[model samples]
Target: MSRLRPGLARVEFYAVWNEVSELLNQGHTYRSAYEFLSEKKKITMKYDSFRRHVKAQFAKKKFMEIDSQEKSVIPADNKPKRVVPATATVQAFDSKNAVPLSDLLTEE
Candidate 1:
């Protein structure tokens, strides 16, 4: 039977995880961040797990930031604006005959 704890509480690792994520965003490689956390901070976890957590945290942060920006930029007026179509010629040419080079090049 494996001795590893199946349900490790994330609350215990939150601070260390945030630190690791910040280091990663500052251009630290996973290996470097792992070493720093393991040796200096005395935080221990599987390298793969740490890496995945850091990536997920960063992705979540980025997504939240983007969502906030989108929300702020959107106008308060919720009414839908009417869309006006452009006035353009809709021409249908006979497909049976090969189109002439000059006809094809001219703007309608």
Candidate 2:
């Protein structure tokens, strides 16, 4: 019952869906599949329309579940674990007590 473009018949609709389903099943990203359909296959459909079709006929839940798992793995605190080496630590008093770099610059 859906209205398609002039050249897109019912059989073509099934064919396009078959291609979309195959690409998605093989773990292709939505953007990659969309680009393949548009650029290589010449499907010429808009983004939202393609997305709707993907959501309806494909494993959208799998993508969502994987995204949620990734989010949960990152800890709330973003602090680094290891302490910086004492040799690398800088002190103002050490610099003040040290011979001036200007003296070295003048001699050089």
Candidate 3:
């Protein structure tokens, strides 16, 4: 189940994602976001579909936080142990002594 309409191209998907992200970052609930989108005549998907789409895309895209710049946005327990700089090259995986590396590899 996903809130996003199927058969949408990348551009269409990004359009909806941008709007939804804005709404969510502004402290709107999923229900409220749906209503807002419906009011704007952007999406007609149901609540369940919306929830699924949000979950599906949660990791694929950057999320906006609903907090002021002066405030600490994320909870301490949720923070990443280390932040990777944008310019740094990220290693896909450590192949130090992995067995059957072929089975462990999967392209994003």
Task: Pick the lDDT winner.
Answer: 1
RMSD of each: 15.8, 13.7, 21.0
The TM-score obtained by model 3 is 0.43
- The Cα local distance difference test for each model comes to 0.73, 0.71, 0.68
- Candidate 2 lDDT over 1-108, as tens digits, reads 245675454344456877877887899988898888778755666666677666755466687888899889988796679996678667567765687889889985
Task: Give candidate 1's TM-score.
Answer: 0.57
Candidate 2, after superposition: displacement of residue 22 in Å? 1.4
Better of 1 and 3 by TM-score: 1
What residue runs in model 3 are displaced by over 4 Å at the alpha carbon?
1-13, 62-108
lDDT, model 1, position 5: 64
Ranking by TM-score: 1, 3, 2
lDDT of 3 by residue, 1-108 (tens): 354546443334356988888889999998898788867877666667667777668754433333343257556688558976689676686668656745668532
Evaluated at residue 59, the lDDT of candidate 1 is 90
Off by over 4 Å in 2: 1-13, 59-108
Better candidate by lDDT, 2 or 3: 2
Kindly report which residue pairs in candidate 3 clash with one another: 2-49, 3-49, 3-50
User: Who wins the TM-score comparison?
Assistant: 1
On residues 1-108, what C-alpha lDDT tens digit does candidate 1 reach at each position? Answer: 223365352433576776776787899999898888878845566677677767777799899999999999998996689999898988777768767788878944
